[model samples]
Target: MKRKHTYKLILFSAFLAVVGCGNQEKKEVAQAPPPSIPIIQLTTKTVTGFKEYPTNIEGVINSDVRAKTAGYIQKVLVDEGQKVKKGQVLFKLETQALSEDAGAAKARVNVAQVEVDKLVPLVEKNIISSVQLETAKANLAQAKANYSSIAANIGYATIRSQVDGHVGRINFREGALISPNDATPLTTVSDIKQVYAFFSLNETEYLDFLEHAEGKSLEEKLSNYAEVNLILANGSLYSEKGQIQTSSGQINQNTGTVSFRAVFDNPNQLLTNGNSGKIQIPTVYENHIVIPQEATFEQQGNIMVFKLQEGNKITTAMIEVKAAIDHLYVVESGLQKGDKIVMSGVGKLRNDMAITPQEVPFEKAVKPIAKLFRN
Candidate 1:
């Protein structure tokens, strides 16, 4: 009986030992190692930042065609976008009525001359007073002046191009009445050999731009300004780059913006009076620190990144971004060269969390991921 009782106690001890070992194994499996996170050290790079502003292109000379005298349009001599020369007749007004009036005026002048001649002969023969001859001469002068005025009106009926360029949209067709007082123009003519790009910036941006430009005077600053690029509405870049020329020099009180002008050569007449595009101005930063935009996350409206610290820990850092270049950001403040930051998994990180840092080359970390998927 004593031996059987000892055997039962040994069996119970064995069962307990097996259960404790299983529990220890399970606990060890649940305690996983800290996750490895990719990290990169910040480094300076020469990057170009682009700022685009919507602009409308205009020919260097845009002239509105209007009738100087009221008349019905008898002809439209040119089509839209047609090239024309100065003094080319664009429209010929119906001058039948003016012609009739001019003929009547000429007949009156002839009749008045006959009367003046009759009075002069009668005065010479002492058959009429000198005052009567003078009156007849005055009447003859009035009729001649009237005839000359009517002839001038006949010439004014022909509408001609005042400039050398391409014709724009014709506002009126044949038989449409055009007047000098009309609000709408007959058509527009544009000299498109070179184009002007008009763009605007807010007061704040204008001030910031002037502050960065290196020159003592506005003219010198404009001359020193970097060349700009034009992006067409169809998303194609223009062949020729443009230069910043003039500025309005005053803020528009109603819009709170300042206007700027840029000039571009349009050799092919590709640009017109009202072509729209975007002006892309590049801001170059030489040897400035840059980091991957993906490595950053917004917290409480501030841009932040997970900084790698001692003991392989990460803490949230606030960084001031000056501009974006491709998929990277140009750092202005709050970060410097030689600072280690988590390259990825920033979304899943918490403040002061321990991590396994997998250091990567700065160039590899900031490689534009967007370009990788391009066809």
Candidate 2:
């Protein structure tokens, strides 16, 4: 019975050893390495500084057409949106009353002239007093002046355009009684061949801009003088360049912003009166340290970046953001050109964390992981 139990135990032990060996063989097959978390190393390159601000486009020339005298409109010469020249007759007024008044004054002047002529012969013959002849002459002169004034009123009845531009809608149609001081405008003519962009800048920004302008090299200053661009209402860029034309005499105390007017050519007539768009004015360029926006992080109201050190350790460096350009941030301080900053996985990283940084494309490192999963 003992010998049988020993044989049974040996058999059980052999079975357990075989099972253990099979498990060891499975463990010996090397597992595939864990998937790598892609990362990017920071490198220095030339960066263009940009200032992002909202702006609008406006017409350089705009005028309201109004009636010069009160009268009933007789005829509308030009239709709305038609091109008109300066001094072109846009509307004619019913001048029947004005003409009749002028004719009546002319008849009175003729009668006065006859009396003056008759008195002139009498005064030469000394049959009448010189004072009477002089008085007759004065009466004739006053009557002629009244006739001339009446005729001038007749001329004011016709309303003409004061500028060369596209005519706006006609406010008063034929037979409508239009007044010179009416609340609504008669029409509007705008010279859309050129447009003006009006903008206001605060005193602080103005001083900084002036200082930058003065400190720049002559070539750079001249290059930036007329280097403003405009994005129109329909999201198209205006082909023409604009320049600073004039400014308001005094700074507005209430707003502390100085108003300025800039003029630009709009030969295509794409710009209209009161049309709004963005105006990109060039602020002076300076040598500033900048980094890609993907590499920057914000912590407790402080801007921070992960800088690589000698031991592949990421050191968090705080930065002062001067401005945000296209896809980057301009740093005022706390950075050097070749600091080898870790530009990816910033949220998961801590100060002095050991990282194995492989130089990866910035575009791929910044891509959303969910987007990759979807693809």
Candidate 3:
């Protein structure tokens, strides 16, 4: 009988231990805290999108200073980067050979004139035929023409600036033989008071620009187009804005792009020929939903965000991004105004996860990119 009582006691003790362990597990489950996450409410705002394209700068007029007549360079009058005016002498070529030829021709002209004078007297005295006198006069005219031609060549030896601008590198120094048929020029001069920024757009982009651009005709559209900003190679904005001047009507066969030219006034002469930069064109979108780029994450090929649902449960929401400017995105679809999305700790949240929603002001979420939305 005593052994049966001890067995009953052991069974009761095991049942009590099991009940205590179950209660402990329930207490631990009650004490667990929900994941904390910062959330932002979406809103519609006016935003402007900017698109940048590579650009190359050129002077309004680029004139090549070349040799008109073949000769050796005697002296380089102007140095590189010198500001010169029209008709300023830039180079002097050796004219010794041309001068010698002119002297010989002048002597021949004198001889021919003497013959003509002698023949006229003979003809009047009936010592020579009138046709012979006429032939002597023709010879004198021919000799004078030869001398004039040689003198003109000698004049061509002096090279002058064709326009008022800055001079470029002088290719031929003193004693360098230059020729009219030579491939390279002696130097270059560029008129840079007003500069041209050249850029290209592909076929698709060109068509889009034409469609969105204001006006019925291409010329009218270009005239009505807004001014664009230029970013220099050193990553600074150009002070003056540029206007679109014109575009190539046809596409380039090799590049599949149409070229565009924009003009900018350079009163200080800061921009020069052969400069490179980027052109920023602005497009405005009204009443568009904008979001911080940090609030969204990429999943597979689609962009996603964790949206706060009823009962503090979070669900993955896919968003369609129309354009990305700076650290913000202009959303096209898949999100609506007043919808709340997790702003921080987006990586820690999973689908249907419960979270303690820490409501953050929408302005605070996108404060870093507020300036980018300016018109």
- TM-score per model over all chains: 0.88, 0.81, 0.90
Task: List candidate 1 stretches off by more than 4 Å.
Answer: 1-34, 118-134, 371-375
Deviation (Å) of 210 in candidate 2: 1.1
Tens digit of lDDT per residue, candidate 3, span 1-375?
A: 999999999999999999999999999998998977888998988877788999999899999999989999999999988899999999999999999999999999999999998898889999989999999899999999999999988988989999999998788899899999999999999999999999999999899999999999999999999899999999899999999999986899999999999999999999998899999988888899989898889999999998889999999989899998778899999899999998977877789998888898887887764456633
**Weakest ten-residue segment in model 2 by summed lDDT:** 30-39
lDDT on C-alpha atoms for all candidate structures: 0.91, 0.75, 0.91
lDDT of 1 at 265: 98
| Candidate 2 Cα misplacement greater than 4 A, ranges | 1-44, 52-58, 215-226, 284-287, 361-375
In model 3, the runs with Cα more than 4 Å from the true position are 1-22, 31-33, 121-127, 369-375
Give the alpha carbon lDDT tens digit for every residue of 109-195 in model 2.
999999999998889999999999899889999999999887877888888888999987778899899887798888898788887
Q: After TM-score superposition, what is the CA distance of residue 235 in candidate 2 from its true location, in Å?
A: 3.1
lDDT of 1 by residue, 130-241 (tens): 9998998999999999999878878888889999999999999999987889999999999999999999989998998899898989898899989999999999999999
Tell me the deviation in Å of residue 261 in model 3: 1.2
